[model samples]
Target: MTFNAEPFTYRIAKSGDVHISREGRLVVMVRGNAAAKLAAALGNGDESDQQLLARATGNYKRGNERLAGSKRR
Candidate 1:
């Protein structure tokens, strides 16, 4: 079996932490707790309230990166 290379769309914006869509429609908007975890997976520094917020809410986007076991800082 084969899967589509681009099955889903991922957007990271300051206005809406993270926006996920399939077939060009907003499927889910992750904020609060969920967003925090996703943001960390994208690449976040240390675990702290302020750091999480910065990662969760900002124009910064992690679109070009992939989830990895570890990344060089």
Candidate 2:
């Protein structure tokens, strides 16, 4: 018996959206609450995965800051 897990990949789109790529092709678009949730999890959660997690953390932090900035105006 053999088992293999699918590869995971994602990128931030031009409109500040998140996307997951599969099999060398763009597959899904992650936006709104879904994107925010993923960002929160990837950031706040204590995980060892550095690269993607760091990106997510940065995104979440920046988004919150932007939201706050807009509110002040």
Best by lDDT: 1
Q: Which digits, one per residue and each the tens of the lDDT, describe model 2 over residues 1-73?
A: 1114333356666666777665667656678887866655553323333344335434423445557647563
Question: What is the TM-score of candidate 1?
Answer: 0.45
Off by over 4 Å in 1: 43-73
The TM-scores of all predictions, comma-separated, are: 0.45, 0.43
In the predicted model 2, the residue pairs found to clash are none
What is the number of backbone collisions in each predicted candidate, taken in the order shown? 0, 0
Q: Please, what's the RMSD in Å of model 2?
A: 14.6
Per-residue lDDT, model 2, residue 9, is: 59
What TM-score quantifies how close candidate 2 is to the native fold? 0.43
> Local error of candidate 2 at 70, Å?
57
| Weakest ten-residue segment in model 2 by summed lDDT | 43-52
